[model samples]
Target: MNIPNRKTGFFLVITGASFWGVGGTVAQKLFQEYAIDVNWLVTTRLLIAGLLLLTIQFFKKDRSQVLGVWKNWKVAMQLVIFGIFGMLAVQYTYMASINHGNAAVATLLQYLAPAMLIVYLLLRKQTMLTRLDVVTVSLALLGCFFLLTNGSLSQLSVPAPAIVWGILSAVALAFYTLYALPLLKQYDSLVIVGWAMVIGGFALSFIHQPWQVDITNLTVEASLYILFVIVFGTMIAFWFYIESLQSLSPKETSLLGSLEPLAAVLTTVFWLREPFGTIQWIGTACIIGMILILALNKSSSSKTSKSNKKPLRVS
Candidate 1:
């Protein structure tokens, strides 16, 4: 690996993940201050960001893929499923989580998807559950316990609705990761994800029209933040992370991606003045530690089997 290239990859992935983290916080701010509707935001975000991504693919990648994804019936069905259940579900549940809770908790809860995926694979008999896998799942569950309950089993520190939405977000994320694998393997991620988002956006727009939302009373700062969430947070963040893969291993990229939840936690606590308990912080460490352990294990495994590439795990 080229040293400078690796440095650039690290920078790109961190910046991309940080943007996603801050974007979640920004979305939370909008929900709190302006009472923005989560459905409308999700719709607008998917439409605008999805189009922007496809436009990029058109200019820089194979233009045929921009429309070619719809050519096959089976692939089209997969894309549609991925759009509704995978893309749309993940986005909606995550936004709902932030609406009911702080960005910090929402992001961390979504990270539980990895453990969930492990269990899913184990159940399917696609992969055997090793001791390390058991440890990973245990740590994830324990971390979530402390993060939500502040180490108390009786009550949740966060709102009940927030817990519900956060777990749904994790499930959606796991589905997003697994369901998109076949499509991702066959086509460029940009193509698959772009079209999936477009499909999701169109489906959502029918139920919650974005134009119906009144933005006339919004301040310039609020407008800018909204723009940042769509443009920087969604489009650029995804783009930069994908680009980073050119120079870094998936394992390395996933390891550094831990910064996403960290950034969300820090920004939520300091920037938004959200209260974070010490136990919650400890829980955060535990969750992040699990990510590190998983990534390191993948790195070790990759040495023996170079063909076993992990799928793209965008937030």
Candidate 2:
């Protein structure tokens, strides 16, 4: 890759991840201040971003793939499964976590997906645990302990519901990362992700209609925040990150992706003034340390993971 392009890739990845982190905090503001429903926000974000992405793909080389993905019956079924379970589940659980707690905690909790994926691989005998993996897992557990409990085992710092939803979000993210590979290998990421979002949004509409949700408290500023979450957060963020992969290695992107949680934490604390305890900050460092270890050791990762070209698409 050209050096200039690599530099651009680093900038794009960081900007995209930062958008995601800030978007989460923005959503938290809407939820806390305006009492926006998580379901409605998820539904709206998916539909709009999905349509926008597909619109972009329509003018690109992968235009054919957009329609081609649904030509096969088995592929269609797989797409539906991925849309509802992978995309929808990940989005809903994450937003629910934010609604129940603050964005910093929720985002950090979701970062545990990589560790969860590693453990899943080990259980399947697809990958063996190394000393590094051991340290990674230990760090993840310890980090989560302090994050949720603030170094106190007897009491929880974050709400019970937030912790539950955040863990579920990680599970959903792991599933998304694992199952999305085959589709992404065959089709462009835009086509796969775009269609998945549309399918997920459509599926969710029957249960939670965005149009019916009360917007009486919606302000001009709130509308802009919502727009930012849908456009900058979902579409531009994913597009930029995917584009950056053309110039950067998966390992490099994974390492830099740490900025997402960092951005979320900083934005939540500084902008929203969410109170974070000292012990909780230590937990955040440990979690980030785990990500660094994982990325640095990517070369020694199992063949199964090496075949997987991308890292977890954390939001």
Candidate 3:
């Protein structure tokens, strides 16, 4: 067995999460400044990113897994479901949340996926509750309340549509995380994620043809932002994050992923000048605290989760 290197894993996951964090900020800029629709961006990003990842995998890694995946009908079916309903749904919803709101709020809300997954496992009897779980749940709930309501019982700090979409993003992400497990076990994550993304993009293209967008008015800055989101945020970020599982524990990787929201919050507040008051700060701390606790709890649970055996474990 290849012993996992924590040093490299930490760097990979951190860089991946950082890119994702900044990517959300760029996405917000595209939505707010460029008026790019969430549908088109998600469609194009998924298609391009998936193709890029598959191309890289084909050239550098296992070439057989790329094409061999289609041979199994059951796997293909599952991949389709995972692609359309899981990965695509998460991508679209997260971007939609950013469209409706700012990156800070959208990113924070998506972090709720871990808690949602825990609740799901509880319902499915796959996992039992521990004291740590209870504390984590409490922190998450309290964090969400503060972040959304801003300590006010009557008024919502953020817009209603954003909140709804943000929650939906979390739900979508939870499903994505769970549904990808079987496929990941069968093939490399690059192959499974790459193909799922292609499938999802194709399925969504019928409804919103990303090609229909007018690029004539596209500003140079907007173009750069779009490129960053597709290349760094979606492709490299996902690739490095997934690759880190080769060396890091799922818990450690997830703990490092807390950087995503932190990055989003900082960039949105400082660079974008989106409002984040004291209450919102408290909420951010609570949620990040929850992430930290989750990582700490699982310190000894698994030393190194095999890449083929584990899906991307993000919080």
Candidate 4:
């Protein structure tokens, strides 16, 4: 097992998010420039990445969790639903959004998941709305408005279909986050995520038929992109992010995850030469600020609660 180190944890999380951002940009390139089918790419990505992750979990990590997660039929059913509706939906919609729009836009739009999750919690009566919640939701909405409209009422920078898919992606992600909590608490993160992706890949294969995609033009460069998408983006990205949780609180990890959209935006603009407007930049800042506020608030509260405990266990 790896020893817990704050610096390593932070670095791993940053690297993971950076890989995801660059991978999304690469997927966008394949979609736009190569005429690759979205369904096939996503289906293959989920299956291959899931297998790679599970192989690692079974060999290098805990082998018990590989089988323990599927012992209960009730939980199994829930996992299936979570995999199909949550994981598959999020993946497909996100890629679809990128297909219709650009990586920077799609990634920033998916960052709306935090706001969507807040609302879902409210609806479930899981938590009451605080002042911070109000601010967070407002900032998300305002940021989205600026991003999509550039503060203009007349036109949208991205297509309407892309916006719809992007919003759907956020909704699916929110579901995936909340629904996977119970499983995550019981099983290893790697096990849960890997199996979920496997289930999702299997279900999506009916429509995508991964074998049907044309790979005649699969050059070395394209092969490298595919490898990165599956290896670095799907497998390593998730592994590093989850591993970081052992050393850092979820709030801190999420705060760092705010780097994802930033990375995507930078890569999209510079690497891919995608255009980003000034108002969109302002919108990005607002969303990132919201993430920071939440992280800071959670950290302060945690410190206060710990201090109030009176060091009862001290020798």
Better of 3 and 4 by lDDT: 3
Stretches of model 2 off by over 4 angstroms after superposition:
300-304, 308-314
**Candidate 3, run of 10 with poorest lDDT:** 299-308
Predicted candidate 4 versus true structure: per-residue lDDT over 1-315, tens digit per residue: 255488888998888878888888888988888777889889988898888878889997889889877899988888899889988988899999999998888887887877887777678776777888888889989889988998788999889989999998888887777677666667776777788889999999997798887787788888888888888877888888877776776766766867777888898889888887899899888877776776567632222223211110000
Question: Candidate 2 residues 104-131, lDDT tens each?
Answer: 9999999898789878888999877888
Give the winner by TM-score: 2
lDDT of each prediction vs. the true structure? 0.86, 0.88, 0.84, 0.78
Candidate numbers sorted by TM-score from highest down:
2, 1, 3, 4
TM-score, one value per model: 0.95, 0.96, 0.93, 0.91
In model 4, the Cα lDDT at residue 77 comes to 87
Model 1 lowest lDDT segment of ten: 299-308
RMSD values, in order shown: 2.3, 1.4, 2.8, 5.9
Error of 2 at 143 (Å): 0.3
Query: Where in model 1 is the C-alpha error above 4 Å?
Result: 299-310
Best by lDDT: 2
Q: Regarding lDDT, does 1 or 4 come out ahead?
A: 1
